[model samples]
Target: MPRFAGKTHTAGHIFFYEEMVVIGAIFGTIFSVFYPFFQFYKWIGNSPVWETVYIILGQLFLCLYGFFAGIFVGCLALAIAEMLNSIPIFARRTKFRHGIGVVILFMALGKSVGSFIYFLKQLFVCGGM
Candidate 1:
């Protein structure tokens, strides 16, 4: 079992990581499937006294969520790249001799800029969300 960080680790640690990922996927699937049945949104909207507090807390929660979500996505991408040996193959195909780090940095920058434009422009809202 390969670790996401490319570090040498014991089998137990690898199993633990796999278990956590599976558990997260299972819970996420369940939540999405039953989202309509969850009344937290309604409760929040109905509570006038706690509305401000809820909004502040909700924003904080979203910030934390976004931070961890970014980490998870970055780690997942790295793991996939390692698994497929994509960098080496890409370099060979392009006859590139060096500056792989620069290529990766540019890719990340592109993604960041695209994401900023997408959310700043509320493109997702136009998708019927």
Candidate 2:
């Protein structure tokens, strides 16, 4: 959260940012706890109109969720990398003196490819896709 605020140059509003983060966490927790109880799919399944609306809205929600989730993960990964100074350390260890940019690019691409595979294979679920 601090990383997000810092990246946006909104460090001065740290309190507001912290409050928003807390509120989001609370809402997320509540949603997770009550999600099965809601059974939205069961309720909407009978109505063609409602089902179409739900599908469209759900896709839009997922797109937005994915966008923010990507931002958070990217920020987290970069923050950890920067904190450890891993890139420079690795470069020095390998006697590499140039193309740090190339290394960073490959690292990012690797992360993207790995994440894509994880989701494509549905590895998050209990059973394999």
Q: lDDT for every model?
A: 0.78, 0.83
Regions of candidate 2 where Cα sits further than 4 Å from its true position: 1-4, 41-45, 86-129
lDDT, model 1, position 17: 75
Q: Which stretches of candidate 1 lie over 4 Å from their true place?
A: 5-11, 43-45, 83-129
Scored by TM-score, the top model is: 2
lDDT of 2 by residue, 31-85 (tens): 8777886678785576888888888999999999999899789878888778558
In model 1, what is the error at residue 80, expressed in angstroms? 4.1
> lDDT per residue, candidate 1, 67-99, as tens digits?
989988897887767845788788989999899
Tell me the deviation in Å of residue 7 in model 1: 1.8
Q: Give the Å shift of residue 93 in candidate 1.
A: 16
What clash count does candidate 2 reach?
Answer: 0
RMSD of candidate 2 to the truth, in angstroms, is 6.0
